[model samples]
Target: MTEAVHLATARVGDLAAVMRVMDAAFDPLFGEAWSGAQLLTLFALPSARVCLAWHGEEPCGFSAARIAGPESELLLLAVDPAWRGRGIGRLLLDDWQAWASAHGADDYFLEMRADNDAAHLYSRAGFVEVGRRAAYYRGNDGQMRDAITMRQRPSPKSGD
Candidate 1:
């Protein structure tokens, strides 16, 4: 990323900005974008957390996740298409993992379409495929796609 970017806890008041990034980042063909009302509801959940990435005053990306007990699940991650390929997605993932860890998470989990390129990002971050559900998501194109579930556990320290 050429420009400096930063992340902050996102509030319900930041819905418009978050939605802007989501609408631009997610392909409508995949039907992966959540509605504004759905997002609002998510903010009301006590276990859910959201982080918004900003480039100056503009929202460039966002990540949403939920933690329960020792596990955390990534619900969404998006970076504005115009600002992609600049490590924004990776930053979001790192921030989410950090937040989860600080909040008592021992394992991080996420599920995405089997064909989603984001898998490479997750893989590089130490997430391994744990399970899959065939024909889990139906796209707007009427084709069904498998959902791949991945998990990342804390790496071993220098000493046992």
Candidate 2:
């Protein structure tokens, strides 16, 4: 049997590992990559939270989000290239939703380039197309891409 991957709340100190995963996961053509300094600035916000999924001693994936008022936005999620097929993205999604809910978020949101293949993953997670931004991102290939914004609300528990 395979050992379980552990999910932990990541701190700003974990930025290096998170960046490593982010850099490995996103291609420059996607235009969704963030710099180390930008990530540090984001983490300084009290409403922001980062979670890391670790397989034993190796960092496998991470998710970052900021919750404010009734809404939460998933800013980034990245899994190491060598670890893509093992459900880490879904794991991070679940944890992000739980954390956001605990912090009083009722609506979850995320936006990505429409061409991104992760749309299926988000759709499977209950997110739906809420809006779009035209020519929202500039790719390294010098092309513009539309951005699809997705939203989801957590389903109530039976006893709740």
Compute each candidate's TM-score over C-alphas: 0.94, 0.92
lDDT of 1 by residue, 59-124 (tens): 999999999998999999998988888999999998998898898987899999999988988999
Tell how far residue 31 is off in model 2, in angstroms.
2.6
lDDT for 69 (candidate 2): 94
| Model 2 TM-score, all chains together | 0.92
Q: Candidate 2, residues 99-135: lDDT per residue as tens digits?
A: 9889999899998989888898999988999999999
lDDT measured at residue 16 in model 1 versus the true structure, 0 to 100: 97
Evaluate residue 136 in candidate 1 and report its C-alpha lDDT on the 0 to 100 scale: 98
TM-score of 1: 0.94
Which ranges in model 1 have alpha carbons more than 4 Å from their true place?
156-160
Off by over 4 Å in 2: 1-3, 154-160
Give the top-scoring candidate (TM-score): 1
List pairs with backbone clashes in candidate 1: none
> After best superposition, candidate 1 residue 61: deviation in angstroms?
0.5
lDDT of 2 at 16: 87
